[model samples]
Target chain A: MVSLYFLLFYINILLIGCVLVYIYKLRKLIGFQLGMTISMVAGGFFAFTSGIIFIYVYPFHFLPVTIAATLLGMAVGSIFGSFFDYQTLLSGYSNGLMMGMMSPMVGAVAKNSFLFLSFAECLFFASLLLVLSSARQT
Target chain B: MILYLYTMLGINILIPAVLFLTMKKKRKLFTDRYGMTISFSASLIFSLSLGTALFFTLPVSFSVLIFISAAAGSIIGLSYGILITFQSLIIGLFNGTIGSLMGTMLAAVIIDPSLCGLPSQFSTLLDRNIILITLFLTLLSLLSSLLLRFSYRV
Candidate 1:
């Protein structure tokens, strides 16, 4: 049987690719609403960038680490002005996939630390949310 | 609503869950994007709900709690008539950990010193085991629904 790490790595990459394709096809629908498109792109960018960062900085801190960032990105994007659109759906799924395949290595640096990661992600997402959303809206 | 919550308790988890229980026929080259979206979001919400519960209710700390919740959440996600694609499982596991992490933070607000960013004694009364766990678990589970997908391409 294949090791969980390698399995997750390849699978996450595949998911990311599929999401990109979906985004490409739904570009018009996403673009229809500027707010949703930007947020979706922001989420995807965060997910991809965070994945790369985790692979380098903390190779073992896969899922939660990357997910924390992606979720933060999505959270920020949605707060701006979310709607039921292709972009919104695809972005959420992409981020979800990123988190799912996050290395499955919960014990790399620390296990319990994920709580902290969530806090950090929330902080970042909240910060981004502040910028994306107005006091009246959010 | 109650059925979904019961799944979080791992009580009658096998029954009403069948509502979300789905089976995958195939992942086609030209797959129905909307359907995939439905599957992904459904599993995500389920994993997130159970994961948050695991972290909030368990006697363990965040590290251990996350592992347990992630495993259980992934299982719950996989059980949803998914085609068992590797991609889907990854997504589910991610939801689980993220949910657990959120729960841990909510609890840590009063329990974990390094967390909370507040004085523990100030919130001692709010830190009761049952109360805190129940409050955190319910709030997270319900709030997570807002993130669920409702619209899909038909």
Candidate 2:
């Protein structure tokens, strides 16, 4: 079960990396509004899922997990937002911070971390797919 | 310790106040996109910093903290968003409220570990962590505000 969790964790990271590449390739085509929304959603969900996973893996180290997750969210948001305008960056950064801070609590409260993580991952994937389709539409 | 927290709160409040004045002075010069961006970012960081600082200073009542933070967030949103347009107002208000909500929840969990299902044995460590997180949040807001101001020059 632990190994399975680790596998899912790595896959998620890989997916995020792929999305970043995809965004970078089409950055010129994306409008500022869409770009802002994309960055905000992408950064937020990534941080949130990662936070939950970290908390689940190391239930004892709440302090480090919280700090790490927050920073990771900020970094991801800034990186994604940097592709477009400063305004996009601002929106993305704030959204990621909020989600990152909230994720651990949500994770901790769940009775079954594995099931919750799977559900959250599905949501994250769905959101990313929506973003990608919308990006393509534009 | 209380004095330090109060000072942090003051700084957080002062940031948005100064930004509002500056934006008001140059309201006419702002483009549509810039106005929306400023409205969104300023209200968000303002509420976030305010919520966190308030929670840290007075970790007394959870319900009260949530109410206060949310109210402060909405007010900041209205003040900043109203300067631009109805759309900006909606954006600012939604983001501000959400930011404060998250901030309150984060602070709550940190203050009381059991609230998040963590073991509640590290009381001393938790106290120190709160101070560190508060300082980190203040610096984050400071950096973002500086960036916001710098955007005007660019």
The numbered model that scores best in TM-score is: 2
Interface RMSD of each: 10.2, 1.7
Q: Candidate 2 residues A20-129, lDDT tens each?
A: 99989999999998998999899999989998888888887777787788888888888999999888888788778777877888888884457788899999999999
**Model 2 agreement with the true structure over B1-154: per-residue lDDT tens digits:** 6888889889988888887887787777777888788877778777887898988887567788789889999999989988878888998899789878877877777778888678775667876777787888888888888888777766
Off by over 4 Å in 2: B59-61
RMSD to native for every prediction?
13.6, 2.1
Candidate 1 regions off by >4 Å?
A1-37, A41-76, A79-138, B1-19, B22-32, B35-45, B60-64, B84-86, B128-154
Lowest summed lDDT window (length 10), candidate 1 chain A? A100-109
Instruction: Tell me candidate 2's interface RMSD.
Output: 1.7
* DockQ of candidate 1 relative to the true structure: 0.06
Write model 1 residue lDDT over B14-114, tens digit each, in one string.
Answer: 32154442233333422444334444555555554455455544567657876776676666555542554555555655554554454344334324433
